[model samples]
Every structure is written in structure tokens, then in C-alpha cells.
Target: MKIDVKVPAVGESVTEATIGSWNKKNGEFVKRNEVLLLLETDKASVEVVAENDGVLAIQVEAGQVVKIGATVGILDTEGKASAVSSEAPKTAPVTASQPTQAPVTSSPASAHLSPAVQRIVTENNLNPSQIAGTGKDGRLTKGDVLAASTAAVAPTPAAAPAKTEAKSKAAPAPAIFAASGKLSKQGEKKIVPMTTIRKKIAERLVEAQNTAAILTTFNEIDMTKVNEIRNKYKDKFKEKYGISLGMMGIFTKAAVEALKAFPAVNAYISGAGAGTEIEYHNYYNIGIAVSTEKGLMVPVIKDADQMSLAEIEMAIRDYALKARDGKIGVDDLTGGTFSITNGGVFGSLMSTPILNPPQSAILGMHKVEDRAVVINGKIEVRPMMYVALSYDHRIIDGKESVSFLVKIKEGVEDPERLLFGV
Candidate 1:
């Protein structure tokens, strides 16, 4: 019997996905529930597992866009895996005085290599045994092979030093004219097709600009108290929960509290004019905008209001790790009532965040700077952070937006307020 392997429904809005790398090749035997390939959706990359233990028969090639429920591959459940042969190396009988020579045979590691890993190994004429494996059951991943290849090849110092000396001598020149080599590089241009994730991001950004009456409101919060609390409790928190205390947890708590106080900030406009409807959420599902190498992905922390500070930190950490590794799923990307993006990590002082459609507002956290301010008629230096809330003006009134931000500012400046749900 043959089993059909079809593209699963990744998300409610995502109708199609690009077939990413196939871990198993056609005619390769895969175990049931083993990851067979990756499906790259707009938001994240999902792992598609084998339906049964069988010989894989891939129907779609990598990088092809397939609609939901379309067949991607087939599994011949009744077929047996090909057996790999091993033969002893033939050598002349060794005399007692003769030193043993290394075996002139390829590493058996090739037997377990994936298509991507096999390509690299073959290209570089590398012995897979020399490289370390980081994947499951000591299997070599593509990244592991690439890293090993890079480390194995040392730069040619003989040519590099001469080029460096020439560049140093040319540094004194008033103007540097482009040589033929430089001109060649300048003229070099290559067009590459955008990945599915990048295309979807571009579309959504343009859609957000076109559909919403977007407005940004800004405020500054003193971080003196928040900093104190974290500094005081971070060690104990980590020891107790096995996760470090982080800024995202505090921000998530504040955002959830503020959303409760001003529910309008958590609502979105569904239609226009008489058909317009303001859909409000009773529970808080806050998204932490994570930037991965592929693109920006917002994985929601569901029912955030019910989670503790330590749980929020752990969840954020897990989301970031999964997003970085392209393991985040469709369910992780959807149903966000509000979002918080910290540009501070990237050293951004201030910026307006674009809305994630259907979610009316997004809170942007910026770098905290030490500045002098007057307190009780005395000049005091304190760490202050500039926060911005970008809201859909159609649904969230300016007054509501301002109040919502004020609540966030209050909760952050005095985190005890967030704990008490004030």
C-alpha cells in the first residue's frame, strides 16, 4: 500500500507554502513520524513528518509552491530499504616490520548523509567522519558540514598579505579610481527570486499601509524601578524557575495589563461604515516579534494574562529558539490580540512599528538611555526608555491609544502595578 503525503493546513490565512529542503530522498526509507521535509510558509518554516515507515517517493521538488492539501510525496509502505554493502579492503599481507597504512576507503558516514549534506561532502571531497554531527542520533546536519568545511579551509596568507600591504599603501591617495577588478565587481548584479516568507512579508506590509489609517503615539518611561526589580529578583527567579529573568516578561505583563484597562487598543475594525464592527478579545494573547534569519515572525504567547512572569520568560525564550531554527509552527503565529516588539535589542532608539493586520495596535520598545531629570527639586540621572504605540486610527481613538500607553508606562515604571493588575 502507498500512502499520500500532502501539504497540511499551516494557517487559516496561508493557502500555500513553498516546499523547502527534503530531508529524505526518493527511494530512501524513512521511519514513521520522522521529519521528511520542511514547508516554508509566510510566517515560519514547519517540519513535515513521514506518515509511515516506508520508501519515500517525492512528487514535488524543493522550492515549488504547493497549495494546501496538495500531494507532495508518496510512501510505499510495503517496500524495503536498500541494503548498504560493506567490503573489506584488500591489502598485501603485512610483514612484522612494515608500518600499517591508513585504509584507502571512503567513510561509511556517507550512508546516513542527507541530500544537502551529501552534496557538500561530495563537492569538497571531505571525509564525513572528520566533521561532527549535531542532528538527532548523531546525524550530520547541513549547517554542521558547512561549518566544518569553512574551518577546514585556511585562508591563503601569501596572497592576502600582499593585498593588505597594497591597500595600506593606497590609503594615502586623495582619490581612488576603480580598477578593472573593482569595476567588474561594481557592474556585477544578480537577481534572485524572493523566498515565500519574504514575499508574504512584503505583501502584508504593503497591505497594512493601504488598508489602515495608521497613527503612532509616543511616550517615555523611567526604568529606575523596573531595573531595580529585575536586578533584585533575576538571580532568585532564575534559580527558582530555571530560566533567566528578562525584559520581555515585564513588557508582556505591562502590555497585558494595559490591554485590559483599555480594551479598545486590543480590538480591530472588521468592516467599513455601517458594516464596520469592532471585534474585542476577552483574553490576552500577546505576540513577541522575533527576528529570524528568514524574516520577522510573531509567535503568540496565548493566555498571557494567566501566566506567571517566569513562565512568560521561558515561553519567549522557547519561541525565539524555535523561530531561529525554523521550527515555529502555524498555530504559534496566529491569534495574537496584541504585539510587543523590542527594537532596543538592535540598539534602535525609536521607531514606529507597523500593525500586524487584524491586530489593531503594536507596542514598540526602544533603547533605555541614562539622562538627567529633575526629581523633587533635585537633578537626578535615571535610565529612561522611549516607547511607541502604533494603532489603527479607525478603531482605536487617539484618546484610547494615549491612555493605553500611559497605562503601559505606569506598569513598567512601577512593575508592582502589573503584578497587582492595577
Candidate 2:
């Protein structure tokens, strides 16, 4: 029996994905539920697993674009895994008419090189054993091969003699050099192909800027009350919930209340032509922007208005971990009425955030700093954080945007209101 391995639907809107890389080579035996390849969609990297224990026959190559439900490979259930040969190699196996070659040893790194890396290694006439792999499972990546090729051609006093020896060792092949010149610093210049996720991100950003009538409103919040509340119950809260009570929960709670008061900020323009209208969502689904190694991701917290502070903290923590590990899915990122991105985590003091398309508004949180302020007719120092709200001007008017921000300030400045449902 043969099992057809097809691409799984990643999301409602995502119909295609690019093959990021294959974990197992063709003809390799894979166990049931083992990861066979990584599929890179616009929002996330999904792992495709084997359905049953069988020998793999890959039909798609790395970096190839494949549609949803397309068969990427096949699993032969009845086929037996190739057995390893135990007989020793002949001392003199080459005939008079055949060329001699050096013996290659099988190592973990060498055995799992991706198709792209294997091509680079073979084309450069380089030894896979010499290159150190930094990828998952100690697999040789294209970067490793490129780095080895660069090191091999470094100019030295014995370059001429070493060149002759290298040629004699392997079949003659053209030396691979950096595009611009001879040996330069390794990291100085090397071209890398853009990934599907990155390309999609760029396109979406540009589209948001081009399509929306974007405008920004800024306000500052005194963090004194919020900090005091957290300091008072952080330990107790963590002990109760097994998660840290972070500022995200407070901000999310505040935003949800504000969105209720100013529904325009939480609405978006829909339809087409003159018949287009503003779509107002009765429910709250807030997207939290998380920065990951691959890129920025926004994972939605469904029905955020109904979740308690402890639940909000747990959800934010889970999404952050998933985004960082590339385990977040497209569904995790879709269907949000609003978005909040904290640049403060990266030490940013102030920045105007761009709106995520279809969502009318996005909130930007900045660093907290102590500043002198007039309170009760006297100068006092307070920890202040500047917040910016960027919204689509067509859907959200200036008064509504400003009022929405003020509502957030009120809730944050008086944390008791959130607890009491004021």
C-alpha cells in the first residue's frame, strides 16, 4: 500500500505554501508521526509529519511552491528499508580505465544534508565531513557549505601548492568565490534568498500603507498605579495561576473596555465600490504582536473582553512561546478586531505603529521613564509611558481615536476600575 502525503490546509486564506526543507531524504525510512518536512506559509512554519512507517519518495523539492492538497510525496508501506552493506571495501577497486576517488565516511551531519546543501557540496568538490552543521539535528545547511567553500579559497603563501593538492584529492571543479571578489570577511557579504514568510510580510506592509488612510494619535500614561498593583499581587497571582502577571494583561483589559466605548476604533471598512460599509464586530478578538526569530507575528486572543487577567496573561505567554518556536499556526494569527504591539520590550521609547490591514487601529506601547509632573498643584515625579494609537482615518474619527486612548489611560491609571468592571 502507498500513502499519498498531501499538503495540509494551513488556514482559511492561505491556499499555498513553499517547501522550507525536507527532514528526510528520498528513500529514507520514516516512522509514524515523525516530521518529514517544513511548510512555510505567510503566517507560520508548519511541520508535515509521516502518517505511517514507510519509505519516503519525495516529489517536491525545497523552495518549490505547492498548493493546498497537492501531493508532495508518497509513502510505500510495503517496501522494505534498504539494508546497510557490511562487506569491507576492496583495497584496489578502481580499474585501469576508471578514476580513483577518496573514501567518504557517513556521519550524522553528512547523512542529513538538504537538497540545496548537497548540491553546493558536490559542485564545490568539498568534503561534507569537514563542514560543521548548525541546523537542527546536526544537519549540514547551505550556509555551512558556503562557509567551507569560502575558507577553502583563502589566499595564503602556500595557496599555489595547496591548490594543486586539492585538485589531486578530488575531481577537478571550478573554485566558488564570493560574488564581488576573492576571499573577503566571511560575514561581510553573502546573498541569501528571501523566505516565503518574509516576502509575504513585506507585501502586506506595503499594501497596508498604500490602501489605508492612516493617521496616528499619541498620549502618555502614568504607570505609578499599575506598577503598585502588580507589585502588590504579582507573587500571589503567579502562585495562583502558574504564570507571570505581565503588563500585557492590563493593557489588553484596558483596550477591550475602550473598544467597547469607542466601537469605531474596533471596526473596519468592508465590501467594494460605493456599496462598501463599515463592519462592526460585536465580539472582541485582540491580536498581540510578538517578535520572533523569523519575523513579527500577531496571534489573536479570542474573546479577550470576557477573559480574566490571569487567563489573558496565560494566553499571551503561550502565544509568545509558540511564535518564537515557529509552532504558531495561521488560525492563531487570524480574525482580530484590534492589535497591540509593545516596542518597549526592545527598548523603544516612542514609535508610530502601522495598522494591520482590515483592522482599523493598532496600539503602540513604549518604555516607562520617570518624569516630573504637576499633580495637586505641586511638582512630583511619576513613571510615565507614551502610547500611540494608529488608526484608519476613514473609519475612526479623530475624536473617537483620542477618546479611545483616554479610556485606556483611565483604566491603566486606576487599575481598580478593571477589577470592579467600571
Candidate 3:
């Protein structure tokens, strides 16, 4: 019986995907739940798994664009098991020297070589075996082959000095052109195609700009108190919890408290029979915007307001590492009521961040710098950071927005307020 293997729905609204690569080839026997191919979508690269044990017959090749529900392969269930059992004994333990006449090289260049390695050998006339392979299963990398070619053509020590002298004497002398009459040579430019994730990010950014009423309100916070607390407890915190207590924990706790006070900033606007109303959520799921090579992905920390400072720090660290490694899922990137982006990590002094759509607000945290500021009528140098809260003006008014940021500023400045629920 032939079983149709169709592309499963990856996520909501994702219609199609590009075939990144296939792990198993046609006619190969595969087991149930085995990874058959990798499919790259606008958001992520997902592995297509085999549904049952069978002989695979791929309908699509790598780099082909396929839609959701498209039949990309078929599995012949009845023939596979029998074929594997029959062929295993015949092909097993076949020795390289078993009277198999030098595996017929079509050309002096045409040994058993990969397409890329073969091309390099044919173009440069280099032997494959001489190249040191760094790839898995003793395959040669492009770098290894190129390096071997250079080593093979290098002049011997006895011939080096004479060759260098001859080349220097034969080479053309430097040409000095008149400045007024000189013709400048144009350099070649290369165009590389953008990845699917990058294209989607571009589209989403434009859509965000068009859809939301973005308004940025900036405020500077005296990090003196926060820094003092961190410096005093950082060693103990790391030793006890196995994670460093960073500013994110302090800021996240503060943000959550501020959200509680200014519920409108944390709420989402939706239309009901009575018209558009503010839907305030008691639970806080804060999205931490992390930048990755693939694109910008935001992973939410569910019920962040209820988590301890140590837990929040650990969660942020885990999510950040996963995001960079591309191990984070589509579900992790969705469903957030608010977002916090740390531009300070990249050494940003100040920036007006744009709001992530469907949500009301996004907080941008900038780098800390030491400057002079008034402290109880006395001027002192202290660590300070500028925080910008960008919100949808349609949902959050200026008073509510400013007050919301002020609450954060106050909480951060006096972190003990977070402990006391002030």
C-alpha cells in the first residue's frame, strides 16, 4: 500500500514553506517518526517527519517551494520491509578491494567525489585524497580542498628564492597616472538574496508602522539604588541560584508592578457589541524581544509578575540562548500582552522603540552611563539609564502612558517598592 505524506500545517496563517533539504533520499527505507526533510518557513525551519515505516519516494527536491497540505512524498509500506531484508545481506560488508576494479573513474578527475569537491578538483586539477577532510564521515570541506591545492602547487625551498626573483623582474612596474586624466576603475558589486525570515520581518515592521498609532515617551531613571542592590547581592545571588542577578529581573519586576497600577497600558483594545473596550488582563505574560541571526523573535514569560527575581533572570537567559540557537518554537514567539527590549545589551544609549502590534506597549531599556544628577538637593555622579515606553496612542493616552513610565521609574529607583508592592 502506498501512503501519501503531505506537508502538515506548521502554524496559523502559514500557507507554504521552502524545502531546505532532505535527509533521506528516494527509495530509502525509513522508520516511523524519522526526520525526512527540513522545511524553512518565514518564521522558522521545521523538520518533516515520516509518519510510518516505509520506502520513501520524494516528489519535491530541495529548494522547491511547497504549499501546506501538498503531497511532497509517498511511502510504499509493503515493498520497503521486504526489500530491506532481502538487500541487507547482499550489500553488507562489501570490501573496497573485493575484485571491484578501481571503482571506474570516468575521467582522471572523476573519482567518487561530491559535486562541490568534484567541481573544485576539475577546475584546479587537484587530487581529492591528498586533501584533509574535516567534514563528518571523512568528507572534504571546500577549505580543506583549497588549502591542499595551494600546498601542492607551492614551490620547494630550493626553488623559492629564484622563482621570487624571476617573478619580481618579469612583473610590470607600477603605473603613475595623471590625477586630472586618470580613469577610475569601477568595482564589482555582489547581490545576495534575503532569507525568508528577514523578508517576513521587513513585512511585519512595515505593517506595524501602518497599523499602530506609535508614540514614544522617554524618561531617565537613577540606577544608583538598583546598582547598589545588585553589587551588594550579585555574588551571593549567583552562588545561591546558579545564575547572575541582572538588571532585567529588577526591571521586569518593576514593569509588572507598574502594569498593575496602570492597567490600561497592559490592556488590549477589542471591539464587542458595546463598541471597542479595554480588556484588562490580571495575569502578565511579558515578551522579551531577542534579536537572532534568523530575525527578531519575542518569547513570552508566562505569569512573569508572579515569578521570583531569580526565576525571571534564569528564564530570560534560557529563552535568549534558545532564540539564538533557533531552538525556540512558533508557539513561544506568540501570545504576549507586553514586550521589553534591552537595547543596552548592544550598547545603545537611547532609542525610540516601535510597539509590537496587537499589544498596547513596548519598553526599550538603554545603556547605563554615569552622569551628574541632583540627589536630595546635593549634586552627585550616579549611574543612570534612559527608558522609553512606546505605545499605541489610540489605546494609551499621554497621561496614562507618562504615568505608567513614571511608575516604572519610581519602582526601579526604589526597588524595595517592588518587594513591598508600593
Report the number of the highest-lDDT candidate: 2
Ranking of models by TM-score: 2, 1, 3
Error of 3 at 333 (Å): 1.3
- Number of the predicted model whose TM-score against the real structure is largest: 2
The CA lDDT at 113 in model 3 is 42
lDDT of 2 by residue, 151-236 (tens): 76666564568667876887444445454535445545457677778888899889789889899999999999889988999999
- Per-residue lDDT tens digits for candidate 3, residues 300-378, read 9999988999999999999987765445766777778999999998999999887776688999999999999988999
lDDT of each: 0.81, 0.84, 0.77
Candidate 1 lDDT by residue in tens digits, 6-63 = 9999878889988876666567788999998888887778789987899887787677
TM-score per model over all chains: 0.78, 0.79, 0.71
Query: What are the per-model numbers of colliding residue pairs?
Result: 0, 0, 0
Scored by Cα lDDT, where does model 3 land? 0.77
| TM-score (C-alpha, index-matched) for candidate 2 | 0.79
Q: What is the lDDT, from 0 to 100, of the residue 273 in candidate 2?
A: 54
